[model samples]
Target: AVRIVNKRGQFMQEAVPVGEGSMAAILGLDSDKIVEICRSVEAESGEAVQAVNFNCPGQVVIAGAVNPVNKAIEALKAAGAKRAVLLPVSAPFHSTLMQPAADRLAEVLAPIEIKDITIPVVANVTAQEVTSGEEIKKLLVKQAAMPVLWETSVRNMVAGGVDTFVEVGPGKVLTGFTKKIAKGMTALNVEDAESLEKTLAALGK
Candidate 1:
């Protein structure tokens, strides 16, 4: 499943045009197939659209100009996609369409002081652990316009002996992804008081 983090309000405040862009979830298709479908649409309509998120094995998200995005969705559905639904978003994030936003974000981050992280943080763009503050800052800027490598990041964590995952957030999305990425791995989430108690009990604490 593809989960979208809506930042349209902030995007509009940052000067991204309204209604000119959109995002859609392409299910039941691998990355290569999704890319192929996007390419076909681009060739036919000459509009920019591409796969932006590799969320899991069989799910991906595409973003770009609204026309092209909708075109790709229709093509994907015709090409045998299980589902292709337009997401409620204001901007085409994580796609080349966001290059302007990414550039502005870089300027916004330039003045901020970033301290070195004590623990390894998997970067969204490279799907690798980044330590240096400088590298982290650069990656953060690039990540705004680059596809999120979430699946690869999870694989790296599993390879590094992370068999148990605790998602501390408002949703259980990551916990769900964890189960799909690594079968039999303990996956728990703490989103509220009740969930926190359940997680604590699961951890025998």
Candidate 2:
């Protein structure tokens, strides 16, 4: 995973110049309204701004060129968004602007040895479980430049009888999202040894 992500980071840098693109989180707005606002911003500015991340209900992230990103932020605020804030990041990820990066990543992945996994994995681009190696490979490439259907992915898992989610590694942002996305579902995070212990105890229950 590290090897794959390292190349992805390099290609992301090459895809867009530093400071040329930006990302913003739009809070307390429906996804449909956010999409409509992004369309208006793109038409007016003739730049690329898209609703990229559907993190949860009322929480969407947009990414594109700096000008349009900011324009969308203002418009979202005026459209009655609770908070539309610019994110501190170097690149506009998971937007059409990252197509170049996706293209590069495709080339890098074509020849690598990727075997099919037995366990199901929900793809970010399609919001569906993909088990075939080839299908997973294609989805991974598209994920770089496509909107992440995180909310849909989580709901799919809920429908599949997954009532508990254990997020390994750092951060509780996903744990928060799961709580909001699937109310009453158990969400646990393991960021350190102590957290891991707690997570295991919770799972044992």
Candidate 3:
């Protein structure tokens, strides 16, 4: 899955020339407020930007053409955002600018065989539990051009009785987000051999 997404990202980069597109994180602002500011900026600047990630309450990510994104950042700060910072990404991802890439990815995904999942997967596109393979494939394509409902997905999992979140791989960033998104939830990270051992010990394995 990672391989396919990385491959398709090449096409996404081509859709927007380097430095022409950008993304930013708006902290201490509501998503609705962020969206409204972005739209107003888009209308005035004749460029496009939108709120693309509802990371958690009071935090959202926006992405689009660089000019619009910069405009939106200023607008959001003026509207009471605590901070708005540009992200270190070459292209604006999960925005309408990625539609061309998503279309091409659909073609590449069409021939692949996808088996149904045994464990329910929370879809980033929908923030809902998905079990069927076909739905998963379709969502993957849509995710390229749609906002991520990360906050909603985490809330849904907690409400459904999930109490522990173990983030494996390079960073503990998601674990930090999990802690902020849900109080009293156990968040763990396994980024190295020591951390893996600690995680196992904590889980009583």
Candidate 4:
């Protein structure tokens, strides 16, 4: 089972839908472990399963693995899912499955005029902060087909003296990962008007 932490407390009482296709988190395993597991599962099941999202330490979210996924797929099946399939993404992503996508992204980015980074944006590919525009561009392209090092990003941010983390996305996914990475740090998520107000009040803004 995946240990999903709710950083903002918003997810503490939320109901998330089982998205299109199938998704499962390889629990008690790192990215490499998950990849190996996916390969084995795929070979036996003859399905197109691959590691997709990297949320936090020792957790790797995998999609595809449709056939064997039923045996090891988390929560969803118990929640009444019959089977999960590979997502409709261009490629499998992150598991050496998206080399083609990476190549394509490289081609697309080669001619684009990228602007310099004005702020310290963390590289999703490396989970390290980068301020150089050129490096950012390359990293961005790679990120499309690479695993997100969110665990590293949060750990590094805490180590680098970030006491507060504010997530501004459609889901509270990043904040949840941050909480798992840095338990001592203050983290918040702002996804709606109420959430925004709560965040401002929490920060005493």
Per-residue CA lDDT of model 1 for 1-205, tens digit only, reads 0111134225433544878888998989778989998988878888779898888887889998899999899888888899987899878878877777677767766787788989999897998998989998898778888898888988998998888889998998878877888889999999999999999999999
lDDT for residue 126 in candidate 2, whole number 0-100: 87
> Model 3, poorest ten-residue lDDT window?
1-10
TM-scores of the models, in the order given: 0.89, 0.97, 0.95, 0.66
TM-score for model 4?
0.66
Residue-wise lDDT of candidate 4 within 18-97, one digit each (tens)?
Answer: 23235565555556756676676678767666666778776666754244455446433343434434344422345343
Report the lDDT tens digits of candidate 2 across residue range 1-205: 7898999999988899999999999999989999999999999989999999999998999999999998899999999999988899999999999999999999999998778999999997888999999998899899999999999999999999999999887889988988999999999999999998898899884
Arrange candidates by TM-score, highest first: which order? 2, 3, 1, 4
lDDT of 3: 0.90
User: Order of all candidates by lDDT, from best down to worst?
Assistant: 2, 3, 1, 4
Clashing pairs in 2: none
In terms of TM-score, which candidate is strongest? 2
lDDT of 4: 0.63
Better of 2 and 4 by TM-score: 2
The clash count for each model shown is 0, 0, 0, 2
Clashing pairs for predicted structure model 3, backbone only: none
Clashes of 2: 0
